[model samples]
Target chain A: MVSNIEWTTKEREVAQEIFDRAYERETGALVEEIRDKASLIAKLEDVWQLHDYLSAKRHNIDGKYDFRDAYLVFVFSQLVKEGWVELNELEDLSQDKLKKISALTRM
Target chain B: MVSNIEWTTKEREVAQEIFDRAYERETGALVEEIRDKASLIAKLEDVWQLHDYLSAKRHNIDGKYDFRDAYLVFVFSQLVKEGWVELNELEDLSQDKLKKISALTRM
Candidate 1:
């Protein structure tokens, strides 16, 4: 269920950069949301609400950043779908990988 | 080994209250810490530092709050050791439980 396309050394570096940038962009938004929520947490119960939110967000982001070569297509697709990555940023990747990521993003 | 002493209805209520209050106190401190750190988190990596801290704290607090009657003595000992629960607050438990918790806290 994963893409097994071969990647060159340059493609690997490009993929990693794209992934890091996407992670930084998305997590920056999450931290902003957390800062706002944390400031409003006046009660013990309100703290649990923030805890639950961060738990879920951490799980989602952890899954998204699974950077195994076999999973990069799926990862990139999710980043694109979430607006954390643009199509042109992935141009350094093989056309095969890009096509797969594009197809998955649409799905 | 755990305490097998039976809990009377009143004892159970007292136990729950002490446990909850201890939890509220400890987590209140944690929330305050998070608020301060979150305000100062200026970079993506700083957010991950908070993320790691929360993950570890959640694991620790979750383990401490298992709340089964069989495990309450051990739980109370930990609470006491951490200064979240005082010995006098546990007076409602049986002498056997109180003694065990008191002894464990010293360890």
Candidate 2:
């Protein structure tokens, strides 16, 4: 089992904001795709892709959101690697955590 | 494991038509749904729903489409029950299979 993250109140709020921003961006892009019409098979592909993405994101975000401090840095790094949460957005986090996240994203 | 379906060429053709029709109709409805834009959450819900539905249909149709004679009756019955196929459309199939399929659909 993974260890629980040690989170300060301010850090928790920042994490929440970062998570929300990433979600909003992801869903916003999906909505735009939905608005575009395509062939039936192509449309099915989009739906399936979106379904997979959202389902996966749901499972990933499910346990991570409740202030699991240990997982937060990795989570932020993952979001950063995907271009969702920038390092600047996570500036409020501790330098130690930010450095690790940055290193992981680079790798 | 299920038994192999005994299929005559005529019956196989009928099965193919039914399968194609069902696929076309199912995908048609989904495509229509795709064209209608909803809220982000609602759109995500639709995308997930479509994803799950298409995934299931693919698995179900995978082996069923091979004209396995034993499974054909049940397959047709299922399609009939779902309103994707009509009894008259399957008239080319043997009465033995048709009666069984019709009974299963009623059940």
Listed in order, each prediction's TM-score against the native is 0.70, 0.68
lDDT by residue (tens digit), candidate 1, A1-107: 55667778889899989888988789888878877777776775676677677778878987879978788888899899989999999988888888899999999
- Which CAPRI level is candidate 1? acceptable
After superposing candidate 2, which stretches have Cα over 4 Å from the reference?
A: A1-6, A34-66, B1-10, B33-66
Residues forming the 10-long window of minimal summed lDDT in candidate 1 chain B: B41-50
The residue-by-residue lDDT of candidate 2 on B1-107, one tens digit each, is 22444678878887788878887776666555544432222565665564465567556655555546667777778888878788998887788777778888988
User: Model 1 reproduces what portion of true contacts?
Assistant: 0.34
Error of 1 at A64 (Å): 3.4
Tell me the tens digit of each residue's lDDT in model 2 across A18-98: 888887776666555544422223566665564465557556655544446667777777778878777898888888677
What's the true lDDT of residue A51 in model 2? 49
Error of 2 at B106 (Å): 1.8
